[model samples]
Every structure is written in structure tokens, then in C-alpha cells.
Target: MSSPIALHTIQYNTQDIDNDTLILLYKNLLKPRLIEEKMLVLLRQGKISKWFSGIGQEAISVGVTMAMNMDEYILPMHRNLGVFTTREIPLSRLFAQWQGKASGFTKGRDRSFHFGTQEFKIIGMISHLGPQLGVADGIALASNLKNKNQVTAVFSGEGGTSEGDFHEALNVASVWQLPVLFCIENNGYGLSTPTNEQYRCEHIADKGIGYGMESHIIDGNNILEVFTRVTAIADSMRQSPRPILLEFKTFRMRGHEEASGTKYIPQELMDTWASKDPVINFQTFLKDQGVLNESLEIAIKEDIISEINTHLKIAFDEDDIVPDKTNELNDVYKSFEYQEIEKKPETNQLRLIDAISDGLKQSMERHHDLVIMGQDIAEYGGAFKITEGFVKQFGKERVRNTPICESAIVEVAMGLSIAGMKSVVEMQFADFVSSGFNPIVNYLAKSHYRWGQQADVVIRMPCGAGVGAGPFHSQTNEAWFTKTPGLKVVYPAFPYDAKGLLATAINDPNPVLFFEHKGLYRSIRQEVPIDYYTLPFGKASVLRKGDDVTIISYGAAVHWALETLDNNLDIQADVIDLRTLQPLDTETIYTSVKKTGRAIILQEDSLFGGIGSDISALIMEHCFEYLDAPVKRVASLETPIPFLKQLEEQYLPKNTFESELKSLLEY
Candidate 1:
């Protein structure tokens, strides 16, 4: 016969918690269980769409939530419904949220625990369980900076431990010594994959040893043990801020979701875990201790059922407000009216890099809540020395040097934004952005639309070719972000525009991708204002004016068009530089195209799926009647950026743009 499973219980005295608090914890535990049971019935009746049942793991959620203070933040997953209830979130609103009603937390945009409310200090988990760990680090970072002495608790499953984000978050948290309680609910499986197949480590707590973080194993099924252990750990962390990993050994009694059954789980394992159901075991323990009797248990059960019914009626009584196209379209981005700063006549001849650094310095002076985070940005001054004396001027608290962790740092920036602070994340190279793409597209881009939460963050991408840095280092990847709905993509050609546009991006109440062409950072020089100023987005700058033909471009491609026009004096054309790609200046393009009667869009990205493709389509759709000839697009070859100068020169459109422009002019 197999040995029986070991169970952990309260090792310390329980006298610290009074009788009333103990009973309150019990009530909190019972709330999610009863509510989940009722939700299952609703699901069966087709009243609800789907459900992720936390039927067996109520103790860990309730105990951890009860242990944390009201001011402290808790980021919980779908299996942690008890966290919401224990925090006193309105059950009616939660029901409305599940029903996709406008009165719910996400206002019908997202379902279940995918939304967060700042008022309750509870951050909802995204479908990706691991990113929340990084987000917790961000919140705790804010706490550390503000001297709040607050501890943040973030939860995940054993399955999430396999993700790179899990390791990055833990490493960064430990490196910064942030006060975070990483609670891992070891429910023995991730979806259908068993623990044996998931990891070779003996226990999840062993992962913490590599990170040099303190860890503990807990009986997740025991409410009293979870409560007492977490309480002690949180208290210690607040006094001496650091991260601790707590592995709550438990099991998932239901499938990953309602549709996926538990058939994959062995019958013996299921039978073993069924005997240790958190709700039933805790209730039995409470009864055995004389804290509850038959009459009290019956009364509590009746009251919970009545409460669930009352909330259900309120939720059902509110008419299901389906999301409309108009509202859905309008809510994609939050508008922050650009406040123009007083213009100063003082000017300095500076390079594009200098102008960017000056603009960042001025903005940091104006906004106290603004922070800069990137690898080697502080002491080492970043890859291109953009942040070179910022550490001394702004202090290490505001200008943080993160580890070589692009994914976690980006999510950390979002966390800072969630705390009502502005953050600037400098990508060492534009190609490195692929590591942090998930948070930018999924979390930051969808934040406002999903929950009316603006991500006041900026990601500075140093991009472009011509330095012979090869494919990885030199890539015009601006097209990747232009297609994303919530992101504002900005690319400047000159020093003056670089400074003004960067200032605007930092203050905008939305996520912005600021691309700086490294080729022009030092090569381009102009007189830029030393004082703070803002430039309006979705506005095109006409560098030169002519009536023969219109040449439209941005970034380094703009300069190439201007040079081509200057050289070929016979070919008079209006050169338009699109400063921002997301909020595109279509009006300027249309007006210029109508006047010139011809247009050629130029870009450094490959020919296929470039931003130029969309511009070409728009011109055809809107300016078809005004065009004298077919709209042309001049772009790089449909291949990776070449390494050799001769091949690269041939690959990019700069050398070929003049020919394309002449062809369009002739037609």
C-alpha cells in the first residue's frame, strides 16, 4: 500500500488571533465555496457561460487574503475567488461582471477576475499567470519608494512556475529586495499536465533557493495554518522588506475550466485529494474545536445562501447592457489633453541624442511621479549613453537600473503606471522588444479598453539600420506596434522634433512607443529648445513644399527623401514627415496628395505588411479620384536586414527611393 499524504497544520500558538477574527475567517472561507456551488448550478441551467471552479482551494485564498492588510495589494488568479469576497468586494457587481453587464468591474469589457479596481487595492490577474509576479514587484517597488512599508501578495499555480516570467519576476524581486509574498498554490497539475511531467525539482520552494529568497511549504488545505504562517511572514517582510516564496501544497478538485473534465487525473489521486477538500476539512476542524456547532453551522449556511440569492437578484434585475460599437470604438484610448509648456527662447545646438536627454531631464523635473527603468541606464548610462548623468541628477529611486530582464521590466513599468505613476522603459535595442511584446500588446494596450485604466508609460525603442550592426541590432520594427490598437507609435527625423515629441509621449495618459533611429542620433544636429515643450501627435510636418508630386515618409527615410529632392532639383515634390504613425496624419497626406496628384510612401521596413501598406491602401480608398497615377510604395527588400554595407545599401529603399519618386512623377 502507498504511504498516506502528509498534512501540515498550525505549529505556533493560535492565541494571537481572537475568537471573532477566527470566526470571520471561517465565514470568508465559506463565502466563495457556497457562491461557487451556486454558480455551478447557474452554469448547468445555461444562465452563465462558463466557470473556473475553485471548489477545493478556498482555504489558501481566504487565509492569504485575511493575512494581508486592507492597504496592501493582492494580485489573484481565477482560482482565487475567495480573495475578492474576503476583501469585501460587492457580490452583486462581481455577478454582474461574470454576466458581462456594464455595471460590473470591467464594465462588461472583460470577464471574471480579469479586471482590477484601484479602490479595493486588488489587481486582477491576466490570463497569463506569471506576469502578475512582475506586476507585484512593481507595486512593491512603489511601496518601497514611498516608504509605505507595505507588503504585496501575488498568487500563481505550479503550472505557472514553468514560465520565464516566473523566474524573471522572482529574480528581480530578490535583487531589489522588494516586499512581495509569492504564494504558489501547488494543485498538483497545470491544466491537464501532471506535476511529474511539469518539473524535476522536488518542490516548488526549491526554485527560491536558486534566487536566494526565503521560502516555506504550507498545508494549503488548512485555513488556520495558512493564515498564521502568511501573517507572520508578511509582518516580518514589512519590517525588513524582502520577498518570500510560500508553496501551498493542495489539489484542484475540478478541471482547469468547466468544459475540461478531470478524467486525466488518476482515480487514486482524485480519491486522495477528495478526502482533503479545503472547505470540508476546515469546517470539520472548526466544529471539532467547538468554535461552531450544528445550529451555528446551519445558520451560517442559510445566511450565505440568502446572501448569494440577494446578490444574484440584484445582478439579474440589472438589464444586461451589451457593449455597443460606438462605446467600444471610443474607449480604446483615454485622452490626456496636451498642456503646452511656456516656450523659452534659450536654444542649444545639440544632436538627436542630446535633445532627447535634455527633454527627459526637463520632464523628470516637472513630474515627480515619473520614473526611468532599463538595463545599465543609471551608472552605465544605457547602450547609447542616453541616460548618462540621470542617476546623479534624479537619484537611484527615480532612475532604476533593472537586470537584463526585458519582459519583467516592461510589466513592472505597467505596474508603476497602475499605481498612478509615469514610467519610461528604454529598450536597449528595438529588436529586444520581442521579449516584452506580450505585456505591451496584451496588458498595456488593452488596459484602458478592458478596465478604463490608462497606462501612463513610454517605451523608448532605439531602431533603424545603416550602422552595420547586422539583423538583430538594426531592424525597423515600427510596423509591429502601428497595428496594435491602444499603442501610440512616434518616430522623429530631426533633433527638434525628437525633443518635443518625446516630452509629449511621457505625459500622455496612454502607452506610447517612441522610436529613435540610432543612425540619426549623433549624425543629425540642430538648434533645439533647452526648456520643456510639447508637440501634438497625428500632425505631419512638411519639410519642403512643391506641386509636382508628394513624397511621404518618417524616421530616417524622411531625410533620404529630402536629400533626393535637394539633389534632383528638376523633380519638385512636397516632402511630408509623419511624426506619429498610430494617430496618422491622413488629412495632411490627402490634402498634399490632392494638390500634387501623385504620392509615393517610403519606409525602411520590408515591402510586405509595412505601415506603408496601410498608407497605400488609405490613399487608394480616400484619394482615388484625385490621383493622376496609381499610388506607389517604396520600401526595403522583403528579407532580413543585410550585414555588409554594399548589400545593406542595396536592400534598403534609400538608394532606390529616388528612382521610385521619378517613376511616380513621370506617370
Candidate 2:
């Protein structure tokens, strides 16, 4: 026969926690298990659409929550109900959230563990598992910079450790010695993949050693053991401020969700884990220590059941939330009354890159919380040298040099934003953004709509095909972000627009993807304003007025459109520069199209699913009746930009813009 599992006994006096407190911890563990059971029941009754049961792993979350101070932040996963319960989240709110009711934290916008309370210092988890780890690292970084001794606890699964974000976040935290505790609940399986298939290491904590961080494994079934160990770790982290990865060896008794059947799990394995249930084990340990008797256990159970029942009744009685269709566009971008700052005529001409750098310097001087982060942004200035003198002026603390981790750059910005700091992230190249797409599209863009949280980050993307940078370094990928609801896309052509739009993006309360055209960075020079000023988003600049046709473009293509019109004076096209792609200037486009009675949309991105298609559809819907001819769309070919300079120029739509515009004018 196998030896029985060893129990970690707690000494009443030495641990500084009384028997009553231990019992309460046990209660915290049991309450979530009972609530999960109720959620499964509700799932069957169709009251809840889905359920993720943390049935066997409640001890880990509760222990970690009990160990940390109330002010410490926690980035929890979907299975972390114990963390919510220990933080005193009302049972009614949890039910309301699961039921998608108006009283829930998200006001029925999101369902199931996708809500957070800023007051409680908990950031809710998104569907993506790994990105939150990076967010935690950023929070820890901000806390350390602000001289706040707050430890951030982030939870993840063994499966999530395989993600790139897991590595990036740990690497950053280790290098910076940030105050973060990465709690990995090793629950034997990730949805359906077994641990043996996921990784070869004997313990998940072993990975932390490679990152130069201390790692430990704990008996996840023992609540007292978890609390005792985590309390010490939390205290040490607050003092010295280093990350520690804790791997809790536990099991998940239920399937990934109610809809996901448990037939894949073996009966023998289920029986083995059932014998080691955390809640039952904790109750037994308390009963053996004379802290919990049969009558007290019965009374505690009754009180919990009664409280849950009362909350459920209240939640069910609440009115169903009806989404306001009129406010669908609200919160997509920051809305504020427009008060234009006075601008003086400039005498000194600067390149677009210099203008942007100057704007960043001015913004950083004005806002103490502004931070700049990217690869080689500190000492080397950046790949484009746009941040050349930033480190010397702002110091390394404010202008940080990040590892080659793109996702973490955005994730850290999101974290800093949440912690009341503004951050600007730089993607080395537009193509490299594919590596960090999840944080931008899934988390940063949807944070406000899902949880009413502000991810006030500005990601600078150096885009457009020019200088023979080839496919990897040169590509205009703004359409990908423009399609996302919560993101604002800005592409400025002139130095004046570049400086002003960048300032506006930095000040906006929402996330912005500012695409800087590398081709125009040095080629375009203009006398930009010396002082701080912000141009409004969703406003277009009419570069030239004409009665023949309306030419709509942004970034480098706007210049191409202007040149085409200048060369063909008879074409007489109205060139409108769309400074912002998302929250597009539809009114301006419509007004110009109505006057010209013709339209031409030009872009540097590929034709397939490009921004031109969206613009064409918009004009067709709003200005179809005003058109004298079919709208024309001129864009790059649908292929990766070639390394050869001649082929690269051919891949761009600049040369084609003149011919397309002339054809539209003739028609």
C-alpha cells in the first residue's frame, strides 16, 4: 500500500494565526466549492450559460489571498473564485455577473469571471491566459517606481506557462526584481491536455530557476500549508522586492466547463483525486485539532448555504440589463469638450521624426507619470532614432529599454495604465507587431468595453513600405487595428500632424496605435509648433480643394495623392488627409464627395481587406447618391514586400495613384 499523504500541521502560537482564523480560511475554501457546485446546478438549469469549476483547487487561491494585504493587487484567472470570495466580493454580484444581469460588475457587458473592481485592486482575467502575467509585471514595476511596497499576485495554469507571455513576463520581473508572485496552479490538466504532454519537467516551478527567480512547490490540497508558505513569501517580496514563482500541485475535479464533458477523464484518476479534496481535507484537519466540531461544521454550512441562497434570490430578482444601443459608440474613444490650445506660427523646420521626438519630450516634461518603453529605446534611442535623446533627458527609469518581448511591452503598458501611470510602447517594426497581437487586440482594445478599465497606452508602430526595408521591417498593417472596436488608429503625414496627433494620443484616456511612416520621417520636413497642442481625432485636413474628384488617403499615401493632383492639374481632385483611420472622419469624406461628385481611396496596405475597402464601403453607403462615377481604390499588390528596391517600389501604390485618379476624373 502507498504511504498516506503527509499533512502540514500548523502551530497555533508560532504562526501568529489563531484557530478561529484557520477555521475561517477553511470556510473560505469550502464556500467556493459549494458555490461552484451551485453554479454547475445553475448551468444545468440554463440560469448560467457556462461554468468553470475550481472545485479541487480552491486552497491555492484562498491561501494566496489570505496571505496578501488588502491593498495588494491580484490578477486572477477564471478559476480563481476563492480570490474573489476572500476579497469580499458580494455573492450577489457574482451571481448577477454569471447571469448577465444589470447589477453585475460589468453591467452585463461580459459574462463569467470577466469583471473587476478597481476599488478592490483586482484586475479581472481575459480569455487569453498568459497576457495577464505581463500586466502583473508592469504593475509591480510601477509600484516599485512610485516607492509603493505593494506586491502583485498573478495566477495562471500549467498550460499557460507554455505561452510566450509567460516567459516574457517572468524574464522582465526577474531582471527588474519587481514585487510579483506568480502562482501557477498545476491542476494536472489544461482543459484536456495532460501535464506529461504539456511539459517534460518534473515540476513547473523548475522553469523559474532558469529566469533567475526562486521557485517552490507546495501541497496545494493543504490550505494551512498554502497560507503559511505564501505569507512568508509575500512578506519577503514586500521587503526585498523580487518575483517568486509558486507551483501548487493540485487537480481539477470538473471538466473545463459544464459543456465540456468529463468522459475523457479516467474514473480511477478521478477517484484518486476525490480522496484528496482540499475542502474536506481542511475540514478534517480542523476537526482533529478541536477547532471545528460536528455542530459548528453543520452551523457553518447552514450559514453559507443560507447566505448564497439569499444572494441568488436577490440576483435573480434584479431586472435584466438592456444594453443601450444609442451608447454603442461611447467609450470607443475618449470624449471630452474641445478646447483648442492656441498655437503660434513656427519658424524652425524639423523632420517628422524630430517633431515626434520633441512632442514626446514636451509631454514627458508635463506629465511626470509618462513612461517610454521599447527595445533599445533608452541608450540606443530606437531603431529609427526617434527616441534618440530620451534616455539622456528623461533618465533610464522613465525611458526604459525592454527585452525583445513585444507582447510584454504592450502588456506592461496596460498594467502601468491601470496603476495610474501613462506609458508609450514602441514596436521595432510594424511586422513585429504580429508577435504581440493578443495583448493589443484581445486585452488592451477590449479592456474598457469589457470591464470599464482604461488601458491608456500609445503603441508607436513604424510602418509603410519605403527605404527598401523589405517585408519584415516595412509594411503598413494599420487595418488590423482599425478593425478592432476599442482601438484608435492614427497615421500622420506631415510634421505638424505627427507632433500634434502624437500629443493627442498620449493624452487620450484610451489606447491608440500611432503609425509613423518611416518613408516620410525624414523626407517630410515642416515648421511644426514649438509648444504643446493636441489636434482632435476623427477630423480630416483638406490639403487641397477641387470640384473634379475627392482623393482620400492618410500617412505617406496622402503625399502621393497630392503629387498626383499637382502633376495632373486638370484632374482637380480634393485631397483630404484622414489623420485618424478609426473613428474615421466620415462627415468630412461625405462632404467632400458631395462637392466633387467622385471619390478615390488610396492606401499603402494590400488591397485585400485593406482600409480602402472600408472607406469604399462607407462612401458607397453614405455618398452613393452624390457620386458621378464609381469610387476607385488604389492600393499595394497582395504580396509580401520584396527585398529588391525596384520590386519594392513597384509593390507600393504611389505610381498607380496618378493613373487611377486620372481614370476616375475622366469617367
Candidate 3:
């Protein structure tokens, strides 16, 4: 029900500048305008590319930064050349960033304005639109866990409010009541489509009404008004344990990026919006206050020009790229193999989900910096009830309940993980994870390679068939993540194994997706170890070792294999659990296949381009010498999972999906 966010109006004089002397209120507004104007000019001249300039949105950025303490976190997008500059990114270095120069960040290796200074508490900028809101919440949520007073401020454009991530981030923030400010730069157009045309809503600010958030829409050009309201909200948000939504009505003086020319924009409207430009309007306000004299104005202009030139010089001087730096691209997009319980001693006392849940709970206990947030995961204890009583144990501060925005949850978790905390984000259902694919594939998967960074995030998706939950509820899309590189996918069929793997994933330096089959939670129960035990990734397990043929699968398929074996009419199959699908246990799979001289892959997911396909490819590449009958597979039909029970049963892989095994046994 939430719509695009906007700002509310407020008025104040310089006295409301947080009772501080060094940082002036008008100066905060002045700084944003000065820097943003330079950035716009750069964009206009082709000196800058991908500029989301804050031309008319200066007040919001200035106000937010002013409201924030120096130690509080601020996550800004490309538009906030103003935001970053106000927080201490040297103007020259900031300008050098537009030139893609080394003197900026990583000697210019990072995307423009995408790098954050740890000292300034600017976690970083995310250009992938609404995703940063989650990241900001992550920082705020972490601060809460650490029992710190720091609040994180996240800024985005009105265009981004339409994105799922924006809503996702906002919902989570509201539920957790984290000390964060969600500001929307509501500049009428999301690349020429009016906000009204693309969306239906009274106001983006009003959108926060449903989720326990305090919402406001400000005249974005009003600097004094912005600073006063933001200062009060940022100061009070921590006490209420809630987030605030401020929509700043502004307009872009230039195109979306550097090249779009605003061809779709009507000139009259453009001129009218421009007439309320933040920089010009604020300057007039300063003049009225006797603060804008010729000497002071000249000084500010000269300072900006000098800073830009300095940055340009640094950029040109060190703009050289390493010959092989770009070559590292391939590894950045690769995924790892899913492994089972490693060399750790095997015990007969554990089930998979129990193991995973224990691991999640234990890891969170060990690392106070780790946060586990999901829908109804706190008091309701998760749909599978994995986190039962965690709200009482961990408190609602650490165990969060979020609105259903799976994609934004993943993004926020990733951003928080990247900013120095471990995050476990849960999807109530595995089938719902598709909502998060945009940031997961385009950003999280490549961030380490792109930024030489690592974000530790665990996504627990309750997946699979057989729960009678129908099409939308039952899905095993681990392979979708399997296909994407830089993601570690784990599908643990047993409880104990699940706990250990979940723990390892929590501690690992990269992103890990842990899928729990909702159908398996109660079906396979065992008493897991009371103490901590870890399972290494990329290690497969031989469930029932056999020599006739190898049956490889994970999650419910492993259970199906056991049932199929119990009803045996086929060859003795060596069933292996691909515990972690990515970073696959090739040696175990290949060795088993080689010894058996036959292999039958089984999975509940569709047949085409799945983890099974990857397993086949690996077997073909390594164990071809051991093949007896063109590596057979038993899987579901390549079609949508049906709503009708009969059709769903017909479409899914069942225990009877043993044609390959039966034929081999007959032979």
C-alpha cells in the first residue's frame, strides 16, 4: 500500500543547528549547492558520466547530514556529491572521482562516488538505486545490536521509491524500529515519466503511515526548513526506535545521467521547476539574512573551482589501469560447489533443519555483530518455527521482523554485511526469493570482484515441494543462485547438517544462500548436538553408498532417493547429498560415479539448466571414463509448478522418478 515518499514543510532559523558552533546551518545548505553545481557542470560538459545530480534537492542532503553526528553513518547515491562532501570527502578527491582517477578510491578503481570513507561514517554509495536503503538499515541495525548511539542516514531519488528495494528496506526498517532516516529525493521525474504517471499515490511521505514510521514531505528547495525538521527527527528517532521518511521535492537541472538530454521533458515545466532551484533559492535566503556578501560568494566559488581542478589533476596523473585488473572479471561472477558435512566426525543424532537452526542461533550468539532478520522470525519463530523463542532470547533488537520484501531484505543484509557486520536475512518462503534477484545478481554477486570487497550475508530460504503449499509456495530455485557466481548455495536435507552449514556460512567472508525445505522440517527430525559443531562448505555426503549407480541430489530429492531405494525395483544406487550446491563436491560425485560405473541424478526442480545440469557437466568433464549409460537423470518436467494437486504431482519429481535407475538395474 506504500507509494513514493515525499517531504513535509518546516521552518527555522540558524539556532536549531544542533546547538553546535563549528557547523553552521546555512553553511550546510551552501556546501551542498556549491558541490552539486560543480558536479552538474561536469555532467553537462561530458567531464562526468552517470551523474545523479542533486541540483534542486540540496536542502535534504544538507539537512540530513547536519542532523547526523559526525560518527553516525550516511549512505548516499551518486546525486549526493553534496552529501559526501558535507561529510568530509575532500572536494578535490570527490571531483577526481568523476574523472575516474586513481587518487579517488582504490587509485580510481571504484565506480564514481561508490566508495565510502570509514572515518567519516559514510558506509558507501550504491548506484543500483534503492538497494542502499537496506544497507543503511544494516548499519543502523548493527549499531542497535552493538548498543551504540549512532544512526545511519540513507538517501535516494524519487525514481527509486518505485523500486521494490525501497519498499523492502522501508518495511524492514519500520518493523525493527531502527534508528535510520529514509530520505527520498522526490524530483517529479523518474527519467521523464512523471511520478504521478508511473505510480498512484497521494504522497510518498504518507506511504510510511502503515509501517510505524514518521513521514514528511518538505519543499526540497527550502534549506532552513529541511535542516530544522531533519535535526529534530534524527535526534528523536533513536529514542523511539523507528525510522523516518523525508521526501524532498526537487528537480534535476540536467539529464538523468550525462547523455540523456532531457528530450522528453516539456520546456515550460522544466523552467518552472528550475525557478525553484535549491542553490539559487537558498542563496537568496542567505542574502536576505545578510550572510551572502560579494567577498564571501567569491570565496565559495573560488574554493569549488580550486577543489575541482585539484581532483582533475590527481585523476589524470593516476588514471592508469593495471593490464590484468579487468581480467579478474570472470572469477568474480563464479559460484562455489555445495558440500556436505566435512571431515568432522559423523554422529547419528541430528536432523538437517535442526543443525541449520542451531548453527544460526549459535553463530548469532557467538558474534554479537551478527543480526538475523526475517518475517515473523522473532516472536512467531519463523514459518518453519526455526527461530522459536528467539525474540525473548535475543530480544526484538537483534531478531527482526520485516515486511515481505524479499529482494530488499537480501540487499539490506548484503549492504550491512559489507559494512562490517554479519547478516542473516530470511525469506518466509523460498519461492519468494525472486523479488531480490536484481541486487543479488547485479550487485552482491560482483561486489567483491568489483570493489575488492567481501560481505558476509546468510539468506535462509525455506524451499521445495511436498508441503501442499501449491505453486507459489513450493519452489526449489537454488540452481538459479547456483548459476550466479560469487554466491555460495547450501541445501541441507538433514537438521544437524543444516545447523553446522548455517554456522559456517555466518562466519564465512562471502555471501551464502542457505535453503531449508519447509517440507523437511517436521518430516526429518533428530536430536542435534547441544554444543557447537561446524561443517565446512563444498563437501558432499554419501547418504547410502552403493556400487551399482550414483544418485546425486539434495534437500527433498535426497529424501525421495531414500524412499525410492526403500521401494526398490532398481539397481543399488550410491546416493550422495550435494550439501552445498555451489563450490560443488566434484571429487565425491566423480569418485562415486567412477566406482559405480553408472549415475542417475535426481532433483525436485525442473530438468533444464539446474544444479543437476552442472553436476552432469562436471561428471562429463571429470568422470567420463567411468560412465556406463550416458549419465541419466530423473527430474521434473520443464513447466510451471501447477496449482492443482494432481498436476503438481505430475510435474514434480517423485520417489517413483526412477526410470533411469530401473533401466540400469534391468540391464
TM-score of each: 0.97, 0.96, 0.84
Tens-place lDDT per residue, model 3, 346-459, is: 445655656666677777789887778888898899887788978888888678787777776776687676567878888888778788777777667767765556667888
Clash number for model 2?
0
lDDT of 1 by residue, 102-199 (tens): 78988787888999888888899889778888989988998998899999999999999999999999999999999999999999989999998989
Question: Model-by-model lDDT, in order?
Answer: 0.90, 0.88, 0.74
Best by TM-score: 1
Q: How close is candidate 3 to the true structure, as a TM-score?
A: 0.84
Best of the two (1, 2) by TM-score = 1
Rank ordering of all candidates by lDDT, starting from the highest: 1, 2, 3
Clashes of 1: 0
